[model samples]
Target chain A: MAFSLDTVIYMDNNATTRIAPEVLDAMMPYLSDYYGNPSSMHTFGGQVGEAVTQARQSVADLLGADPGEIVFTSCGTESDSTAIFSALRTYPEKNHVVTTRVEHPAVKNLCDNLETLTGRKYHISRLPVAEDGTLDIERYKECLTDETAIVSVMWANNETGVLFPVEEMAKIAKERGILFHTDAVQAVGKIPINLKDSTIDMLSLSGHKLHAPKGIGVLYVRKGTPFVPFLNGGHQEKGRRGGTENVASIIGLGKACELAAAMMDEENTRVRALRDKLEKGLLSSVPKAILNGHPEKRLPNTANISFEYVEGEAILLMMNQHNICASSGSACTSGSLEPSHVLRAMGVPFTAAHGSIRFSLSVYNTEEEVDFILEKMPPIIARLRELSPFWEED
Target chain B: MWEYTDKVQEHFTNPKNVGEIKNASGTGNVGSIACGDALRLTIQVDENDIITDAKFKTFGCASAIASSSMLTEMLKGMKLEDAKNLTNDDIAQALGGLPKEKMHCSVMGREALEAAIADYTGVMLPMAQGEVVCECFGVTDLEIIRAIKENSLASVEEITNFTKAGGGCGKCEGRLAALLVESTDKQSSPATAQKKKKRMTALEKIKKIEEVIEREIKPTLKKDDGDIQLIDVDGDFVTVSLRGTCAGCYSSQTTLKEYVEKKLREQVLDTLIVEEDK
Candidate 1:
C-alpha cells in the first residue's frame, strides 16, 4: 500500500522527531523576514541577536543551566567532539580517556580514532555494560585514574534506551579531578535534567531528537570548565565554537525545548503508556518476543524488543507496509554486517540481536497510533517467523 | 531503506511457496542466525530428475526473502541438471535487480540451490572444501574465487557486496584482495600471453578497440551526455577524442585516463596505452 504523509505513524523519535508546529511557527519569521545576521552592527540584526539570546535563555532554562554555558553547534556530534577535545587539549599530560562500550558512534568512533586523528596514542578504557544494558558504576570508577583527561559516557543508550547513571559517574569523575561529559541526546527532554545541581562538566543535546529542526545542538559546559574551540574561526559562541549561528534552527530548538519542558509530564505519562501498551501487546501476542533493555531503567518513551528467529529488517519492512515507522538494531538494517554495538556489548544472543526493533515515542504519538501498531506488529512478526528457517513452533 | 525493486517488494509482501516440503527429496540449509540471514530450501524431484516442487524459508532482510521466493519460483518445473546451472545473477535479474549491498542475498539463494542439488545427487560440494577466508561469514577462498569469476568482481568491496567476504571486522580484506588478484590473473593469463606476443594486427586492434568503444564505453559516457570518438591507433597506443559535454571538461583528462584507458586495457589488451587526442 502506498503511504500518505498524514497516515504515517512515526515512532522513531530516538532517530529524529517531527518539528513541533509551535517550534515551526516560532522559526518561520526568523527564516523569512528576520534574515538579519545575529552578529550585525545594525539594530535590525541586533533584534535577531536579542531573539537568539532569548532562545539561548529558553534552552538554558530547560537544562537548568546558565545562558552563558550553552554553546550551540551544528549537531550533537559536534557538541560531543567539542567537549571531549576541549578536555584533551586542557590536560595535554593526560594520556587516558574513559567511556562506555555502548556509546553512540559520535563518541565511540572519535575515541577509536584518537591516535590516528591526533598522532598521539591515548589509552582508552571502554566500560562494559551488563546483560540488561546497565553499566556497573564500580567498574566505571575503577577505569578512571589520574591519567584520564575526560570521562565521556552517554546518559542513555540510543539503540536500547537503557539509562546510565551519568549523574553519579560525573560526580565520581569530579572527586578524581577528571572532566566528565555526557551525550544526553536521547535523555535530555525525555526525562528531567538539572545540570545546575550536578557535577557534570559537559553535556550534549541535539535539537532534532526533541522536536526541533536538525543541525542545531547544544553543549552545556559548566561555568568553571576550561574549554578549547573545535572549529577555530571568527569569534562566535563566545570563542568556544566558531561559526555563524544557525539562527532559525537555534530559535526553533529553543521553542522546542520550551515545549519539551511543558510536555515532560505528558511524555512520561501518556507517551510512556502508549509505548508500554505497544511493547506489552507485541510481547504477549508474538511468541519468543523479548525486551532488549532494562524494564525499569530505560527511557520512558523507548521500547526495544526482539522477535527471535526473524530478521529485524524484514520485520521493519513489513511494518513499513502499514506506514508504521521505527528503527532496528539488526546488522542488515545498519549495513554493518553486525548488530548494534550496544546490544553486542550487553551480550545479547545472536538469535535476538539479529531481530531487535526499537520504537521510540514522542508527544505527537497518539493512543490510536499505539493501538494501530499493537494490531499490526504481531502479525508481522508471525509472518516473518513463518518465513524464518530457524523458527520452530512450540 | 534499501531501495528494493517493485518485484522485490511484491515477492516480500506476498511470497510464493513459503513452507517446508513434506517428505522432500532433499533439504539444504545454509547460513545461520548469527550471520543475520539463513535459508532452508526443500525441493521435490520426480523420477525423471525434474524439480516438481520447491519451497523456501528464509530468515533475513526483504531482499533475502524476495530472492528466496524468486528462486523457488524459478526452480519449479525445471530440469535438475538445468537448475544446477542457475546463478545468483539470474535470481537478481528475475527480481529486477537487488541493491548492490544486498547482492549477497541472491548469492545465498544460489548457494542454497546448489546445496539442495548436492543433497539430492548425493555428491559433496567442492566449494565448501576451500580454506575459510572471511571468518565472520564463513565464506571460503574457493567460493570467493568462484564468485569473483562468475560475477567478474574486481575489488574487495564488490566481493563483500556479492559474497559477504570482508564485510565484518574487515580482517580478511588483504586476503580478499590477494584472492581477487589471483583469480583475475588466472582468468586473464591467456589475454596476457596474447599481449606479450604483440600478436594483434593493426586492423584487428582497431576492430577490437572500436568494438569495446561501441559495446562498453559509449553507453557509459552517454549516460552523462558525453561521447567518445576513436581518432587514431598507433601500435599499442590508441588515441581518442571526447565530444559533447565531455569535450574540454575540467575532468575530461581524468575520464580519458582513469575510465577510458582502464576499460580499453581490460577488454582489448592490457598493454594498450590510451591517450586523449588533444
Candidate 2:
C-alpha cells in the first residue's frame, strides 16, 4: 500500500493544531534556560519579564490592540470565564445577561450553570440562532434589556464556523450602555481583527487553538472597560488574573501571533481554497450531502455538513481508521444524548443532525490532502448510508 | 465522545449488507425525520420462508448503521420466525455490545424488521394498533410492547433507542410509561388467571391501570408542577397524559418510565411496558 506525500490531511483545525516549529523554537529558551520567576527582582528575572512584555506587545500588535489591554490567561476558557464573570460582578445592579443559543460549551455551560454560579437571582436570555447558525441581530437587540449587564457573543462559532455580526452587536450594546464580550477564539487567527474599529469590551482568544501551546490565551479588555477579576490571589495581570505566568507558553503564543500576522494572507487564499475544495468535492461527490453553516460568512477553514442519513460519529470512526481526522455533531460525540446546540439551534432536522460532520482546515493543510479526503469521504458516506435503515426504505 | 465499546466501532467501520435490494419482497421502515434515526430493512425470502438476502439502509448515528448491518448479516441465512423473534438486545449482543445509550440501535433493527414483516404480510403492525407515542419517532403501542417483550426494555431510554419513542419533546413519556405497565401486566398475568384464560381482557387492564393512576400516581406528579392526562384504554392497554411543565420537559421519559412504570408495575402488573401517545 503506497501513500503519496500529499495524502496526509489535517482538516480539524478548530479542535487544536500542531504548534509551528518557529513558535516552539521561540519558546524553548524560556522553558529550559530562563527558569527564573518573572516577579523576582534580578537581571535574570527582569530579562524574562521584559521578554513577556515584548510578547504582550506582539499579541497586541496583531489584534490592533494596546499592549496594556492584553491580559494573558491560561486558555480561552479562562478568558471567557474572566470576561463573563467580570461583567456580572462589575454590574451587580444589572440582573440579566444576553448571549446566543449557539455558543461553544465553555460559554453555554457557564450560562447553564448561572443558577448555581450566582448566589442571587440572574436571568440569561439565550438568543435564538437562525437556520444558518447566525444570531438574529434583531432578536439579539430585542433581548437586550435596561438591566442587561453584558451581551456575550462569539465573533465566530466553533462548530458551524458562522461569523456573527459582532461589530453591529457591540454597537447596539454600547448604545444601550451595556458591556460586550466576544469569545473570539476561532476568529482572531483566521480573520482580520482590528480592535480600534470595534466597540467590543472584552474578547477572548486561546493559544493552542491557534499554533501556540495549550495553556495560554489572551483576554483583550479595551482600555476603560468596567472589569472585575474572576480570579483573586495576587496583583498579577494587573489584578485581572492571578497566577505565576506560564512564560514558555506565553512566549509561544506571542510567536504564534506573529506568525499568524504573517500568514493571514495564506488563510484568506490557500486555506480558503483548500476548504472550498474540500467542501465542494464532498458535496458534489456524495449523493445527498448538505453543507451546514453560513455559505459565505463562515470561517475559511471550517465546513460543517450533514450526509443525510449517516451518523457523524460513524463517519468520524471510519475516517479515523484511515488516519483521516474529522469531527461530528452527533449527541454521541457531544457527551449529551442531544446533538450539538449549534446544529440544533439552526433547526437541522433530527434525521440530519446525527449525520453532521465538521471538516476544519488550517494553513498547514495541503491540496493533496483535500483531494485524498475527497476520495475517501464520499465512499465512507456511501458505505454508511448503504447500511442506513432510512436508505433501505427510500 | 461516548465510551463506545470496541465492538461498536468494528461494526461501524465495516458494516455488512449495505444498499437497497431491487424488487425486494418486503421492506420495513421505522423512525421518522424528527427522531434523529430512521432504519429501513429489505428482505428477499425464498420459497421456503428462508431469507435468501437482506439489505439495509439507515439514517442515524453509528450504533444504528452498525445495528442494521449486524441485523442484515444475522438474517441473511435465517428463517423469518427467528428474525421476528430477534430483538434490539440480540442485535447489540451479536455485535459484542453497544453503549447503553446506543442500545436503541438494536431496537431500531427489530422495529425495521417488524415493519418489514408487516409490509411483507400486508398486515397491520402491532405497533400501528396503538396511538403513536413518541411524536418525534412516530412510535405506536405495538412497537413499544414488541420492543419491551423482545428486549426486556425497562426504561424510557431503552424504549427511545429501539423505537425512537419518548425521544422528542417528551410529552408522550407518561403514556409510554402506562403502556409499559399494561404490556408487562399482560405478560405476567396468564398464570394468575385461575379462569384458564390465555390473556387478560383489554378492559381489565385499562380498569386496573386507571385505578392505579388515580390512587398512586396522578396526585404526586401533579404536585411537582406536572399533570397526567389519560388518553385511551384498549385491550390490555392504557394511555395517560403528561401536562403542564412536564409536557415540554426533556426528562419526561424518566418520569414516565421510572415513576409511571414503577407505579403501574407495583399496583397493576409486573411486566408492563409504557408507550407514549404520539
Candidate 1's displacement at residue A282, Å, is: 1.5
TM-score leader: 1
TM-score of each: 0.86, 0.76
For residues B1-278, what per-residue lDDT tens digits would candidate 1 score against the true structure? 78988999999999999999999998889999999999999999999999999999999999999999999999999999999999999999999999999999999999999999999999999888776777788987788988999999989999999999888877678777877787788565322322332234457768999999999899999999999999887556687888999985767756877899899999887866665543
**Candidate 1 chain B — worst ten consecutive residues by lDDT sum?**
B189-198
Which digits, one per residue and each the tens of the lDDT, describe model 2 over residues A132-250?
A: 88777776776676778888899999988999999899999999999999999999889989999999999999999889999898899999998888878878778888888999999
For the second chain of model 1, what is the TM-score against the true structure's chain B?
0.67
> What tens-digit string does per-residue lDDT give for candidate 2 at B1-278?
55556666776767778777899989987765455667778899888888899998777677877788888989998998887787777888888888776777787788789888778878877556665555555666666776777667787776776566676555567766766676577664322322322233345667788888887788998788888877775322345668888876767656877889788887877656553442
Worst 10 residues of 1 chain A by lDDT: A138-147
lDDT of predicted model 2: 0.80
Clashes (candidate 1) = 0
The worst-scoring run of ten residues by lDDT in candidate 2 chain B lies at B190-199
